[model samples]
Target: MNHPLLDQFNQWLQQFEQTGSVIDTTRLNEWNHLMDQFQTHPEQLSSNHAQWIKTLAQNSKAMMSVVEALQDQATDSSEQLKKLREELHQFNVQLLLQQASLPQQMAPLLFTHTHLSTLFNEEQLAKFEQLKSSLNTPQFEKLNQLIESFMQWQQAGQTLTEEMNQITELATQTWQEQFDDSLSAKDQIELWGKIYDNTYQVQFQEPSMQLAQSGWLNGWADLKLAWKQLLTQLTEQAGLPSPEQLDRMIEQLDQQRRRIRQLEKRLSALESGDHNG
Candidate 1:
């Protein structure tokens, strides 16, 4: 929209149309003269034209960086979630093996029934069922509830991770297709701007985006809460603090340390005043 050179060219076109046909020698000569002036003295272009192009390139790079960051976040979350799931799976396997070997002695532990079922072949399940009667009824019920809660958390985490990955892919594809270094700076800026606007709407305001937003954001929050619950239960069983509890303790300790430092400074100032007095 702000292409000064294009605007001048358009003005020349209008003059040519008004003054004479393209075949007119006089009009052609005038056009040639204009071109000669532009070619001989590039200063005819705005002084800040190069600066404008640089700014446009910088803006484009910044936008690409945002997409890259989002992609990285999605990738990190997916990997972290995968690792957490693997750890939880391994723990479940160990617990199942222990219970199957000595059901009467083993304490009840929560495991996602569906996921646990998948791990066991029919033979293993049949083998494990021999000790089912030995399970504490009340503890079994608690474990069932815990497993259900964990499943909800797992579902949310999966949904969020999937949606994040999908969006990142779409953004990356759009950026690549629209980006063109060969285009003139002004054309490039305009093209990139249009692409950005359309891409933004498609990526953020479309039905897919709306659904992702609703599901992923809330799912992530719910997963965090569920993780805390699971962590708390695990910590209690292990006679150790949950990560959340440890984090809170660390935060409180930091605050107290800062307060102590402030108080020490105040006490030092009072002593200095007293000595002066």
Candidate 2:
């Protein structure tokens, strides 16, 4: 009787033996013992056990491929972010130099024998200079701050991604180190949960994560506000009630319902008093 499983097991054993450094001696011994048992008492091999083993092998391979893909994506994104950060830094430097040279560059146009110089007197030129100075007002300062903040947010996002990749790799290594083939599916799930909890705890303490969280929250809030504004504009354009108007209408309806409830309570109280009398 030719046993397909026995043949397969023998092939696996032969491959494992050929690759001497693939597994430790103890692990190799364990595989040899299992092979021996399978061959000696083929009837003792449970279909359930075989199925479980096959499923576990498939899942492990799938998980490893997913981890590798994620690692590659993170690496690529990190490289792109590095390039972006460098470009942004260069752009900022150029922008600052251009801003600094603006007055000097424009002064020649206003003061020298140009069309503007012929058209405007000294007083008008002074007013134009004041107008130029007004560009450095509080609003412009806030705009500059917003730009700086956006840059910081991008840097923080990159840092957070790098930290996450490191944590993922560490967690994967730790899980591999602690993995036991003898453990049941439930036990493996519990082990994964513990690994996830530990990784999250470590990640939560990271400064990059905190900055990224804040940036995400702020961005979400801004998005919501912008969306609301857009909705309000659309509603107004369509001659429909805006969000604020709808809110006020809902509030008034609630107040009217409360007043009606109060009146009903008073009427019931009066009727009860009359019946008592």
Which candidate has the highest lDDT of all? 2
Runs in model 1 deviating more than 4 A are: 1-198, 201-211, 244-248, 271-277
Best by TM-score: 2
Per-model CA lDDT versus the true structure: 0.53, 0.55
Lowest lDDT 10-mer window, candidate 2? 111-120
**Model 2 agreement with the true structure over 55-86: per-residue lDDT tens digits:** 54455555544444444456575654444344
TM-score (all chains, Cα) for each model: 0.32, 0.37
